[model samples]
Target: MASFVMKQMVGGKLNEMKGGLDSLTGGNEGEGEKTETGEDPEVVAARLEQEERRKDKHRKMEQEREKMRQGIRDKYNIQKKDESGGMGGFDMADGRIGAARKKTPEELAAEMHAEDDSLVGQLGLTEHVEKAKTAVNGAFEMVKGFLPFGK
Candidate 1:
């Protein structure tokens, strides 16, 4: 009984080692184990061809869109920016023309202030507001000058 158990254990270990070695050597075990979907090779090729055709169709549509955009630009006499260099209206990365760049904080603040000033001007209080701002600034400067520590 002991000899039989030892033989079985040794046989199992040998079989495991053989499988490992076969795998390391790129054995044909994978080929035989592959599950076939029963689809014909010709059908697979047709599917791939169809996918290629769909991709081509999308590419052509995108090209047509670009052509339409170009036609509109030509009508308006707008030149597209060169991809290499120049600050023209076209965005090189996205291929979009006249794309607005993001404004910095200072720019946003300046725009807000300009809008406020325009609103104030529309209300006919521009001169009065300017005079008030000047008076306040002059008062601030006069006080600053009187402070000896600032000098």
Candidate 2:
């Protein structure tokens, strides 16, 4: 889903670039710069496309953040939409909630460690994702090994 949104954003930007290039070349680029409302055609299209891309990016970020928030809530046995309301934003942060609830550092540490073990065991990730993660991580480490810091 995120990838689809990203692709849409990239495609939209490419189209906008092409439009701008054609506009720069000549006023005879078919659409000219006149709108039905007597407004600038190029400006209207550019504005509309920018708005669409902005909305798309916002929706994508919300979805990705919600997924992460729900994952954390699941680990801590919390509700997705409890009586207090949806904790989709910063209110569900681990450190903030931990402090408010009086969870000690050592206790939080243990919980985090246990959560890590269960997460890898129960995430239900596909074999393809696991393989891709391995490949990506290996690539990352290979680059890191060649860093100027001489690790």
Q: Which stretches of candidate 2 lie above 4 Å from their native place?
A: 1-33, 36-38, 82-151
Indicate the TM-score of model 1: 0.31
Worst 10 residues of 1 by lDDT: 29-38
- lDDT for each of the candidates? 0.81, 0.77
Query: Candidate 1: deviation at residue 49, Å?
Result: 0.8
The residue pairs in collision within model 2 are: 33-41
lDDT of 1 by residue, 1-151 (tens): 9999999999999999999998899985445443376565667788899999999999999999999999999999998876676455334455665666566799898986786657796798877888999999999888988999645
Give the number of the best model, judged by lDDT.
1
User: How many clashing residue pairs appear in each of the predictions shown?
Assistant: 0, 1
Q: What lDDT would candidate 1 get against the real structure? A: 0.81
